[model samples]
Target: MRPLRNIFAAILLLSGAALWATARADDGAGRTPTPHPPRAQGEHCVADTDFMRRNHMKMMMAHRQDVLHEGVRTPQFNISGCVNCHAVKGDDGKPVSFASPQHFCRSCHTYAAVKIDCFECHNSRPETDGKAAATEIDGEDAARLAAFLRETKQ
Candidate 1:
């Protein structure tokens, strides 16, 4: 009876191993793996010119101190605002994007001696989708946004 029990235990162990191997094989064979898609043209959902005009100052203010630091802390804000504009389709055929204070904000900020550490957390290129571009903003809309930024500064 003891010998029979040992045989049963061995059989159970073998069955488990076999099942695991079969599952792995099945997983591999279940579907044809998709190839990575190509990089999309343009800067994703960002409004190239308007985005540059608006929010540049606010972003600069947020990163000014960090830019001066040799070892800066990770920024408190994520790229959501910038991503709202810069979001683009990714190489994997999914939405991907980034927003760097340096890329969008540095030109103006540097003129004012505001050092920006844009590379710390933000990538030079952000991914985005067309959702951000669907909004119909006129010149007045851009001007208003710019005015709001100016108000924030004061």
Candidate 2:
């Protein structure tokens, strides 16, 4: 009877250890630790750090249609706003572009295994203040577009 009692006690101890281990594992799975946001040279963000960390994607998505379709550009949601602040300078003092992992966006995106397509169509660096708005459509294309619009109106 004493041996039986000892066996039962051993089993209980093992079961408790197993339960503790399982609970600890489940806690981790529920919220895997995220990598810390990279420190940029800029001290402040457009939004609070916590808010930006959580909902930046949603903010950018909403701003895209507003800016692109409506031509309503605002400082707060401009992609250049982010680049101007977040871009890390290279050895030459020019910014490292989004293609590099050292870039603020790429660092987090790479850690999360997320691929962003924004840079494919947009400039990765902040545009120079002296530079005029450069359009991809050249003079011939502009004239052709004007002619098409005129012909369609008639």
Q: What's the TM-score of every candidate structure?
A: 0.23, 0.58
**True-vs-predicted CA distance for residue 138, candidate 2, Å:** 23
Computed on alpha carbons, the lDDT of every model, listed in order, comes to 0.47, 0.69
Give the range of the ten consecutive residues with the poorest summed lDDT in model 2: 132-141
lDDT of 1 by residue, 5-118 (tens): 999999999999999989978786544342322333445533344573566556556665565564464533344455333344444653332121223343344345444454
Best by TM-score: 2
Off by over 4 Å in 1: 1-77, 83-102, 128-154
Global Cα lDDT for candidate 2:
0.69
In terms of lDDT, which candidate is strongest?
2
User: Model 2, stretches more than 4 Å misplaced?
Assistant: 1-36, 128-154
- Taking the tens digit of each residue's C-alpha lDDT, what string does model 2 give over 1-154? 9999999999999999999989988776545455555575566777898898889999999899899899988888888778767767666776656544456776677567666767657756655575522324445444643453344342
